[model samples]
Target: MNTLYFAYPGELETPTGGYGYDRKIIAGLEDLGWQVELVPLGAGFPFPAAETLSQAQTVLEGLPAGAQLVVDGLAFGVMPEAASLACGRLDLVALVHHPLCRETGLSEDEASGLFESERNALGHARHVIVTSHATATQVADLFGVAEERITIVLPGTEKQDFAARGSSGKLKLLSVGTVVRRKGYDLLFAALDGLRECDWHLDIVGGLDADPGCHAALLQQLSGLGLTDRVTFKGAVAPQDLSGFYRQADVFVLASRYEGYGMAYTEALAHGLPVIGSGGGAVADTLPDGAAIYCGTEDTGKLRSALKLLMTNESKRLDMSAAARRAAEALPDWRDAAAQFAVALGGVRR
Candidate 1:
């Protein structure tokens, strides 16, 4: 039987997109009859403590020689030394969702450090897997990895029933993502500030606990703008519960600064909700034109204009919603993505 070792940071069940992709791909691999071993590393990743790094080193060093190993970029990007050591002992592959240094809110020095470390680690890998073509291009251009060395396996979206929006007089806008600096919740709030004159209600569905300070700042912003009454923070919802939220909402939006692969945007399209988001990173690749209103990461004025246009014009909203459904239909399923992932692994094994 074919065997593979999957190494990643934190629990496999985490609600983030990277974790979600990992979980799905693992199941898919198992279904394809591969003997997959799960290796959970230290939790302090992307900026691990010294002890955490030591623990990761010990774990990776213990892998049997010639074993095929796939490392998640979150942890692997910061461990050039560990990766280099492991590479000599095993067939190593790096599954990068996006370049770690490209995350928003990093200082120049920190970004540079991460870039150098990640580039070094990737150089030792036999093959690299990314979730989007944009990421594939980024790694080639910035990290100097050859295009042939990288494989793009886009995230899959489930086929779901179209959203049945409520007939409520107010427009319902839903935004799903963790309350982090990169998600651009602050920019979203600023964009919505001027749209108070319109009849609308927004539900921010994401984990607030991930960043308590950011959550507190968002709450303060809501209160300052007297928007507490119209905006609701639903926190993170279970997978089963998310469908209901999509069913009730009229529109979906997220002003993310960057996305390795905007799974949330795809989910919105799957639900047939008109989307408004930044045209950064892999978002443009995932979301087709005419289906979403694109704005720059920092362009609150443009976002406000898009929101206003969607809110006031029912025909336009319906047209975009239909376009979103059509786009979702054209997206690849998890099975297809799994097959692609398996093919990539086969290449590394050869």
Candidate 2:
């Protein structure tokens, strides 16, 4: 049986989309009879301390010669030297959810450093797997990797019953993602604040602990706008409970600054919730026409107008809900994604 060593940062069970993709892919690979090993590197990655780098190096070195090693981009981007050391013996595959440099709230210098480092690290890989076509193009263009060397394995959505729209008169908007700067919860708050007269309530379901500072700032902004009563911060829900949030919500909104693959948006569509989000990164590819209302990340006026229309116009909302369901039914399940992943890996052996 073939063995695959997967290395990633933090706990594998983290609630973020990138980690979720890793976990699901791992499970899928195992189901296909691959002997997969999961290696968790310590936190503070892609910007690790000296000790973290040393530890990662040790982990990579310890793998058997000629082992098939897959490194998540979050850690691999900044570990060019370590990856280069392993590339001589191991078949290195870089699994990039997205480029680390595109993360929000980074200085130009920081972004440039990450971009250059990632470009170098990816050069050592035998193959690169990205979660979206948008990210594949990004790697080819920005990192100068050839397009044929990259594989696009889009994220899969679980098949679920359509969300039962709440008839509570008020529009229940749901936003799901970590409460970090990248997810753009602050922008979502600002957009919703301007539509106070639209009779809407927002439920943000994500981890606040990922970035306590961003969480605090969002809370302050909500208080300042007196929307404390209108919004509820339901930090990270249980898997079962998350489905409930999706089922009860009338619409889904996430104004993310960038996404390699916005799993939350796909999950929302799986539950037949109309989405409202920025047209950045891979979102345009993930969501279909008539299913989403797209705007620029900073276009609060456009988002507000979209929200207001969805809130008051029942006919339009229903049309979007139908479109969302259609899109959901067309999405590939995890099994199909895994098969594609297997094919991608097969090419590396050739």
Candidate 3:
């Protein structure tokens, strides 16, 4: 049997959302009768830069001739040596959540430079898979790669048991993902500031990653705005408990500036929770028409209006809730994702 290696240099069982995409892809591949090797590399901040690069190089060197290697774009993007090693290795491919270099809040010149480097690095792959068409277009445009060279595989939510449960006394609002600036927890706090009088509580479930300064700043902003009591931060809950949280939430919101693919948005819809996501990026792709309200940007007034409409109008909420559930049911499973992966890699070794 042919072997495939899925490489992610991080804690294998960590609950961080960043690692989920790679894990899911690996599982999908495995289910399709492929002999999969999951190679977990580093596990800390600053990510053992020099040592990891050397170790990754060693791992790539060890792959059998014609074996396929699937690298997480987040880790692979920085390791130029690993890219070189991959070039020599058999049939290298990449699964990019989004180009790391295209992240929000970077200066245009800096973004442009990083984009160029990422385009070149991604070009090294025999094939590229992105989570959304939004990301695919960005990569194709930036890298000048043909659409045929890339494939879009939307992330899938592992099916969860959704027992019938009544909502908590307060109108519960939930947001999951990293506590980073791009996740827009700050905008969420600002929106909460305006809805202080409403009988609602907000829960943010995500871990702090890469930047502790942003985490501290978020806490300070929450305190300064007097939202500390109303907004709860449950840092990294287990997967089993996540469904309970989703069940309790009356609505789910992703206040992100952008998403390569908003998996949480889909997960919320799967649980029958109406979503309020910003309009651009992958938000439109995730939320079906009328299943969620789409805000243009961070206008607290706009968010406030949407929140009031959803909260006060019970009929509208229930309508969107049904629509969301239907949308979730319509999504393709992981097997479909893997089939697409196989198609993309058809020209390369099996």
TM-score of each: 0.97, 0.97, 0.91
C-alpha lDDT (0 to 100) for residue 306 of candidate 3: 84
Encode model 2's per-residue lDDT on 151-237: one tens digit a residue: 999988999976546357878889999998988877778888878677888999998898899999988999999999999999986
Candidate 3 TM-score over all chains jointly: 0.91
User: Looking at candidate 1, what is the lDDT of residue 139?
Assistant: 94
Residue range 1-350, candidate 3, lDDT tens digits: 54778877677566755577666667777787777887765644123567766776787777777778878877766665567666765788877887776576677876776676577777678778888989898778877778887888777765555443343467888999878777888887887787777788888888776568888999899889987888888888876687888988898987888788888888888888889987456777777887888876666667778888876777788888888877877887777777777666665664
Worst window of 10 by summed lDDT in candidate 1: 161-170
- Clash pairs, candidate 3, are none
Runs with alpha carbons beyond 4 Å of true place in candidate 1: 164-166
Q: Is candidate 1 or candidate 3 better by lDDT?
A: 1
Per-residue lDDT tens digits for candidate 1, residues 7-91, read 9998777778888899889988888988999998878789988999899889998888899999999998998999889888798
- Ranking of all predicted structures according to lDDT, beginning with the best and ending with the worst: 1, 2, 3
Clashing pairs in 1: none
lDDT of each: 0.89, 0.88, 0.76
